[model samples]
Target: MSSGKGGPGLPQERKVVTEIPGPRSREIQERRLKAVPPGVGSVLPVYTVAAGGGVVVDVDGNSLIDFGSGIAVTNVGNAHPEVVRRVQDQVAAFTHTCFMVTPYEAYVEVAERLNHLTPGDHEKRTILVNSGAEAVENAVKIARYATRRPAVVVFDHGYHGRTLLTMTLTAKNMPYKEGFGPYAPEVYRMPMAYPFRSELDGPATAAQAIDQITKQIGAHNVAAVVVEPILGEGGFIEPSPGFLPAIAEFAKANGILFVADEIQTGFGRTGRLFACEHEGIVPDLITTAKGIAGGLPLAAVTGRADLMDSVHGGGLGGTYGGNPIACEAALAVLDALDAEKIVERARQIGDIMLPRLRRMAEKHPEIGDVRGRGAMIAIELVKPGTTEPDPARTAELAKACHAQGLLVLTAGTYGNVLRFLPPLVIPEHLLNEGLDLLENAFGG
Candidate 1:
């Protein structure tokens, strides 16, 4: 694809030099079975030796076009120049002084940047953490502390994380929650405004959610209403119009903190700087991670100053919460996001992908619905002539894409959605080529 050439290091083109899991990868997979637990799964079996631009070079020398940016973690690319430079410099200077131990300027800079970037103009505060789940848990902790309430309302088809509390918050039961109990208590599930499958429209869905929360959990007893503006793992489900605003309004009216989980849709992953911006919903608290720090482990909870400051200083920190290297990486990521005009690039990607996928959907009856915004897009597959989920077909299509050197990811509570998350730096030609491979996979 694209003349089988690359600038330097990892290429920007896809080249299938061997079978999907070539001999080398197969060999490594054997070792992995012994070393790694089966519970920790991977979408692709090929082991990556190096990755950059739009391709991942596996140990077998096959260059696959990356459609899943490590589940939206590498929005700026896997090895962004500025991020690499900052991380290297920080590592050389000192890897860890521990933000909670000695403190660091980069951490403060990152906090300040998040406070300014996340939706909302009012005075805000931020606490840095190590992962999306940590950010979410901390956000709930802060909300509960500020409101002195016990109940936290989440939505059906939502996925927060694998931690005890987040697992309870997540809606999917299979791999995330089934046997993990006893889960954290006080987390209640509500109906989501999924446009494709829902019987109700946006406002009606909001009404149902509000009514359920009011009747099931008393308004005064609820601490927060956590939502993903565009649900990520549960599928790139952008709730119908007017849904988020109504929910936010109801939350405010009831004194329930509205928390937007932008972990997968933040830092230019979506066309906007934040997905909530698309709906004009200003959440009382927001959780961010993944794309926040290139590939480094980092997350944050930015919220209203009063709510954030409610918890005592010592009550909100970790030994490696804001590791200096992660902070430096985050700082670089924020700079790249603005300097490279990545948000605009994300919009451009959405412009290219949405139309292409919609056209593809027209040709394939198996594709039930194509949805999502920006680089974060997905297509839900269904049984022929019906709306029922077809996870088997979804898995088969993903396997076909992988065989053709296109890396894609699957999501949805039913596991019937094919999701894409190309890096912001991917060239247009590479994107087109990847889509071509996907089209061929569909045909096959």
Candidate 2:
């Protein structure tokens, strides 16, 4: 790793002064067991004290190289200077004006940015919300309100969120949808054109999916077709080429809305402003969160003006929908995203990471597929000589990496994909260092 030249407040090296969850963190974990519920789980529960650039410092003074970015939330880095400054200033001025009550310009500015930056160039409108689930639920609400249709088409191996409606929309059944029952109705699941597994090419897969949707759900009854350009929690699956365009085209042809859930793929995570851009598919509505506000709780649904306007003003807001602090942070995030060259950085990261991961796959027979774009990448783990999911190996490898002071996240419906979401600000040397740690963990 680089000796110095880390970002402002973080070092560029992985320094493990103690064992991975040292005595101090272990004590905290005991307290946490008493305070926090078992249902609320964590991949790594070591209790972070400070984080920035590419490293998370734990309570015991060990610095672990971050690959999760809090699940793609810290794209611009933790405690980004401009974001911190803006939030500090805004907090001092007034923490909460409650945009729905007193109103604020920061909220409006964020909406304007979302309207301008999202896929569409046409006249658009934006509504802010508290989380990605809220954005998604609101998108569906708006689509139904506009189209007066009941059925909403979703895809397999897609994750929306944990809210009642979004949990139903999510494909996985275990943690997200298990005990939660009576999911929101009128949400239909469709086949996704995952390139690695599907036999058909992109266009054929799209055609097959469209045919199934037409026969099963019918064109006139569908309100929207909600999809993630790159299925995030579903193993970073990049749907085959022409799949998204076909879906978007069918949605439009039938007067149904196309909603692109960019919650995990937005703000340069996928080497583009939005992953839909990669397919040249301009969606009718786009949901964004995570990386948008530099770790603040914020999400938005930006859409066509007419569709958004159909909901009426009073129908589409919450008291804390556009919290002033989050808005200010988001404004700062946009500025940093542009000024720091984050989009370009994402592409550069992919350039460095993809080759290394492909090389690793070559060495490790357990690696089934290395897929995804930009900083949002994943390696699907499978049994040797077959495509059966190897979640046990994935967990073992993750534990080994954690022991070595590296943080990685696992994803996929089968829970066998190791996803890498290192912050765009992560120093190249630190990233390489983290990858080296992974190589060692995997016995390379």
Candidate 3:
């Protein structure tokens, strides 16, 4: 199938006018402060006026090489023509009918695509939601309903969402979970295999973790074990080779559902369509959001049909769940992913980025570790020799990059990991340019 065309086309090259934020953006910021909430923090002072392919043009006419990809949401690149057209057409023809009342074909089609795309050959079903957190919350509900158990297991440093239930599931304390308390109960935390810091290898660490959990919590009492194949907010840490598979086996033996939170690692971000595919292990349930709709707000839980069916006919839906426009945008994203070879492009990005990051780690003693899968990569900053996190240095580096026209994000429980989620469609030269800025930030 040919890629559909719509939305504004990408410019041939990036252009910078005035400084990074420029004057117009500063003016807009001043205006925004008068009306907008103070809770929302501005990263780079610039406000995006247009974006296509791999670049974002701010209101001040400074075109930047987009490295953030809107927090890894636009894997197919910003305003992908096909996605834009599909969304545009969808908006024109009945924007909202409340899928619970008058369902649409696009919703079903998107679900079908997810069922087919997610890891596993077994019969699978899907439930679409508005965001990654909603998908995770619903997945937990399904698991509990299916097993008749109350407790759900999540890994340390694993980030599920910001919702009440997921906040309890999340490992970080400050900002996301601070004072947001009275979180939903029955959520348990377990240590994930952090090879850089752990004493045991992959399988040994997995075994140790499982043993502790089963002994303390009783695996039989747990409804599900949630993990990120490649840790997202927890510094993009990839579980040691045997860790995930071992955990999967334990979950299966204990009759607990294995849930893979692929909100950040799914949809070709990690070379494979799903990060779990690397282990050839199929999770009982997979939660996905970012990159699935190429920028539209859409997320889903794809899982074994039997477990999914446990929920009553009307129990597993939302009023605006699976918005038709978002569904259409998702379908377009899938088409672009396949026809445009985006999966391969993601692999190419990883090939270009990993080596450069590794070299950076070699030169900078502050870089404690460089890790990730595919393009979903990160470099953790430490206080040289010690594993002690250096969030202050991470902040400095990010600020430096931002000033020089690159946008980088910091993650990890300690907030000392610098993650790169550049668009797969970004030109090779532009990728190198971003890397050069990063090198300069590190004192190259």
Candidate 4:
């Protein structure tokens, strides 16, 4: 392992020199509980001091193998050399003048890159934002403005964001939507093309969604049909093939914009520039984040020029929408995506992990499904004799993995899915090691 506590180029191996949450981490957690509100939750309680490559070094110097790349935000790895260099240079040059106030070249450059990188060769425009939620809100705003419609159609098990409108768009209730009631109006949740649980196929699911749109919501009243090409927080479920294309076609035929929420699956996370490309669907608007700016807070909405330009002047920007440091980081990230062959690396990761995960599934009766592509993969847990969700076992498995120095994330509407989103830059050895830990967790 590269010798270091934290920062880039550290050893890409897991070293559990202490308990998962050692004494130092326990002290920090005690401090955190008092200082931070209870609503702000964390999956792993180990406070991180440094993170790089495939490992995160905790306060107690325990290096854990990362199976979750900060929920897919660090696809290019944390503290990449180019990203660090660009961010440092941009910081020294100037912190923020507010793109809306005086404007800057980095913001425009980031927009241009997004416009070019997103799906479809058609002339497109972009608006940068602070987070994925902001990007989704902006995309919906543009679609509504352009289409002159009030309703937005979302799918079951879709996760947009935590903001007011996005929260309404999301389907989960307990944690995301539970006491937060009286959500935004005119946002409709439709049946998703979930291949594992639902009996409907791709074309059939699309037909049902279309029927609901026309009969229930009225097609003309719909502004957009927003979906995660592959569901993210809702268990990394990849919909049945042909489902996305059929939906996009219906949306286009009805003059409704199809928005692809690529926040979790964009920027080389899924072996492609965007997950929507896997199904050959070109969205009218795409919301991107999580992996856009390395670890920096940056998101974007890129779409057809005509639709994006529909918004009135002074209606599309935010105070810190495109901070220069983040823009420069984004530029560096975009460059590194190509320069380092990160997209190909994601595909290679899938090739190595999927088969191993399948083998693990064969031995574990609790593993009901093994799904996802590239570096974005997951296994759903179920009862031994039936399809009933086994969230308790899923949590137990994750905790076991954590104890063994493998950091894993749990998701799903039922909370029974264990998702693995390793950084594309993670070493092959670490990937194998992480999977081995996961297999061992299944045993216990």
Top-lDDT candidate index? 4
Across residues 75-130, which tens digit of lDDT does each residue of candidate 4 receive? 88889888889999988989999998999999888988888889899999999999
Mind giving the per-residue lDDT tens digits that candidate 3 earns over 106-126? 999998988988888899999
Q: What's the true lDDT of residue 262 in model 2?
A: 97
Candidate 3 overall Cα lDDT vs. reference? 0.88
lDDT of 2 by residue, 332-417 (tens): 99998889899999999999899999999999999999987999999999998998999999999999999999999999999999
Supply the TM-score for candidate 4.
Answer: 0.98
Ranked by lDDT, top first: 4, 1, 2, 3
Give the Cα error of residue 221 in candidate 1, in Å: 0.4
Task: List runs of model 4 lying over 4 Å from the truth.
Answer: 1-7
What is candidate 1's lDDT per residue for 1-444, written digit by digit as tens? 233223235656678888988998899999999999999999998988788888888888899998998999988888888888889898899998877778879989999999998888999999999999999999999999999999999999999999999999999999889888998989999999899899899999999988988899889999999999999999899999999999999999989999999999998888999999998999999999999998999999999999998997699988889899999989988998889999999999989999999999889999999988889999999997889999999999999999999999999999999999998889899999999989999993
lDDT of each: 0.91, 0.91, 0.88, 0.92
Worst 10 residues of 1 by lDDT: 1-10
Q: What stretches of model 2 exceed 4 Å from their correct place?
A: 1-7
For each predicted model, how many residue pairs clash, with residues at least 3 apart or on different chains? 0, 0, 0, 1
Off by over 4 Å in 1: 1-9
Which residue pairs does candidate 2 place in steric collision? none
What C-alpha lDDT, on a 0 to 100 scale, does residue 117 get in candidate 2?
93
Give the worst 10-residue stretch by lDDT in candidate 4: 1-10
